[model samples]
Target: MIQVAAAIIEDEQGRILIARRKPGKSQAGMWEFPGGKIEQGELADDCLRRELMEEMEIEIDPYAFFGVNDHHYGATHIRLIAYRARYVSGTITLTDHDEYRWITARELTAFTFAPADVKFVEMLHSSKPRLNE
Candidate 1:
């Protein structure tokens, strides 16, 4: 199974950030949380931090475990580990995505997300606020 780590980065207003997968990348054109595969031997939290920095040039402090999901996309299967995180610093400068948006949980359904992320989106919409402001 592919080990992945993703963040539910909430802003002061409680909106979460989502990124549009860039063309030429896996799941291109789909909107999803910012994260990447966790390398072997790397902690999920560390992987999340590294991915955020690499993909958006931002820093975050992940807190409170959110949830996990197992998904299969054709021949690729993934186990996504998600966490609730607070933005710490750095302006988001996307390098791997075509666009980015900050939307409230209720607005998640408005965008087309990668299939592997559909459950995460549902969780966010269904659950009470899990992260502290």
Candidate 2:
């Protein structure tokens, strides 16, 4: 089983960030929340922070733990822990993705996301607001 961490990074404007995977990468050309697999002994939040920095050259405040989704593709079983993150700092210099976009809930359906990510997206859409208005 492979353990992965993903962030549903949202800005103050209520837009969520999504990235399109670069060609030749795993699940290439598919869109996903910015994150990666967790290494040994690394906390899930720490892994997510490191991945966001490495992949997008940005820092994230992973203050909220959303939920987890378990998925299996072929012989690999993946456990994806999704977090509700707020943007902290740094410019997004796409190191691994072909493109990035800040999207609204309705815009989410237009992209072709990985099967695993699609589940989380649906969950996010159905979930209540994390911040109090």
List TM-scores for all candidates, in order: 0.94, 0.92
Model 1: residues >4 Å from true position, as ranges?
Answer: 129-133
Candidate 1 per-residue C-alpha lDDT over 1-133 given as tens digits, one digit per residue, 9 for 90 to 100: 8999999999888889999999999889999988999998998889989999998999998897888999998888899999989999999999999999989898899999998889999988887764542
Candidate lDDT values, in order: 0.91, 0.89
RMSD in angstroms between candidate 1 and the native structure over all alpha carbons: 2.2
User: What is candidate 2's lDDT per residue for 1-133, written digit by digit as tens?
Assistant: 9999999898888889999999888899999998999999998899999999999999999988888889999999999999989999999999889899998766788899998888888876776654532
Please state the error at residue 98 of candidate 1 in Å.
Answer: 0.7
Model 2 residue 13 lDDT score? 82
Candidate 1 whole-model C-alpha lDDT, 0 to 1: 0.91
Let me know the TM-score candidate 1 reaches against the reference structure.
0.94
Q: How far is 83's C-alpha from truth in model 2 (Å)?
A: 0.3
